[model samples]
Target: CNALNASCSDCLGNSKCMYCYTDNTCKLYPSGKIIPPSSYCALDKARWGTCLVNFEALLISMGVIGGVLLLTITGCCIYCCYCRKGKNKRYEREDAKFESQRMERKARQEERRNERRSRLDEIRMKYGLMKEDSAPYTRFDA
Candidate 1:
């Protein structure tokens, strides 16, 4: 209703006309004006000023941050997995090489021991300490 168009005769002396102005109005009161109050609404259309939060911008920022964190974590996991696989392969190769060398060293030591035993047997035979039919000396005999 237009406050200015109301007539005093229509009230039949029971009601009075009151003009609502912006100056004396409460800050929380709802106004029918299409434009918002400058105190509560920002000049920039993107913002809601001090009274409200910009949920669109807030949600978008959160999504972006979450995406970045997810990508970073994924990248780190992939890198760690790759590095661990490579390290395991390297360790296996080194272990196999070491095992082969150990086996070869054992074979060489056994050959040397056999050579020493043969030399001792030849010396015993020449000194007439053991006959051709006698059993060879053993570690337990010593």
Candidate 2:
């Protein structure tokens, strides 16, 4: 009886009521009427005991799931930002390369133009198409 922690004298005598270690009490509801010694236990169990384990498990699972979701979202955001930054840097490098190539092409074109002009001047000198002052001759007929 001491080990069982029975509340009612009948429970102690007849071994009918089961003791709950969580609340340290015995509970009994006979013929739809609650006994006084077990009333507190019954009320407490009704309010907090029925769904305690499931509630705690659900709360823990939700917290874990929320944390994982947050981590995933943050990781994806960081990855996307890094990818965009890398792409931007790549684009900048490509643009710089293209600009350098365009400048080289322009320099080559200028060199060709200069060479053609020099050749034309030389041909004019060899054919006597220019005067002594290096100006071309123009006809004036009255």
Candidate 3:
């Protein structure tokens, strides 16, 4: 109900939009001119400014920054993947080294068991408890 006339009547050919005042008057933007319905609103002509270029520059700068951030995130993701792969390879190498160490320990234990068996056989031969070239005796045999 507060809408005013928004028509321009001046040499600049600018039109005024009705504002929320319900006064039936047109006021020019950027100019403090109040034009009644009977007179032309020439005094309220808007002055053209260079704000469009500034807005365009701001938009382009934001786009460039956004693109740079996207590329940086992508690069970081790739680097992290490479680092994770390297860590996995390192872990596999360590696991293989541990397995080899376990196998060596088992081999050493088997060698020690063979040495004890040979010593026992020599003792059996000396005591005349074993036949020549026979298998080693268990505890039940003695």
Candidate 4:
């Protein structure tokens, strides 16, 4: 007896339909009120359900995006650490090589100094500059 679109012809001839408000999707109401019944309530309930699904999808998408960002940052850190380790090892090897070269040069210089000291002692002994019983050498006067 209500307007033709107000109710589905298949469900029932009774035009009184339920109203939907989120939690309360269906509550009985008489026909011909300002609010349309059966079909309208069902349509509103379907719309609300669709909105909820879309909101859930949005949250899931944000989580995936955040996870990607976290993984990218972690990967960059690992790469930097690996590169830095290589640089430090190279520097240490170079330092060790330089130190060994310096040590060899120092040993050669020490040998030359010892030879000079022995020559000076021999010259002093031949010239009788030092007494035989005296210590082999003393500091030069000048």
Task: Please provide, for model 4 over 28-128, each residue's C-alpha lDDT reduced to its tens digit, 9 standing for 90 to 100.
Answer: 44445543444545443422113343223444566899999999999999989998889999999999999999999999999999999899999998998
Ranking by lDDT: 2, 4, 3, 1
Q: Which stretches of candidate 3 lie over 4 Å from their true place?
A: 1-54, 131-142
Candidate 1 lDDT score at position 125: 82
Q: 1-142 in candidate 1: lDDT tens per residue? A: 2333343232122222221232322132224643344554332321222213332454467789999999999999998999888999999999999999999999999999999999998998899876665567645754
Predicted structure with the largest lDDT when compared to the true one: 2
* Each candidate: RMSD: 14.5, 13.1, 12.6, 13.8
What range of 10 consecutive residues in model 1 has the weakest lDDT sum? Answer: 11-20
lDDT of 4: 0.58
For candidate 2, the per-residue lDDT at 12 reads: 37
Q: Whole-model Cα lDDT per candidate?
A: 0.54, 0.59, 0.54, 0.58
Q: Write the per-residue lDDT of candidate 2 for residues 38-136, one digit (tens) a residue.
A: 443433332112333332344466689999999999999998999889999999999999999999999999999999999998998899975676457
* lDDT, residue 5, candidate 1: 30
For residues 1-142, what per-residue lDDT tens digits would candidate 3 score against the true structure?
1132442222114333322123334444434543233233222322112212322344456689999999999999998899889999999999999999999999999999999999998998899987765567646755
* Model 2: lowest-lDDT 10 consecutive positions: 46-55
The segments of candidate 2 whose C-alpha lies over 4 angstroms from its true place after superposition are 1-53, 131-142
Which is superior by lDDT, 1 or 2?
2
Using Cα atoms with residue i matched to residue i, what is each candidate's TM-score against the true structure?
A: 0.54, 0.54, 0.49, 0.47
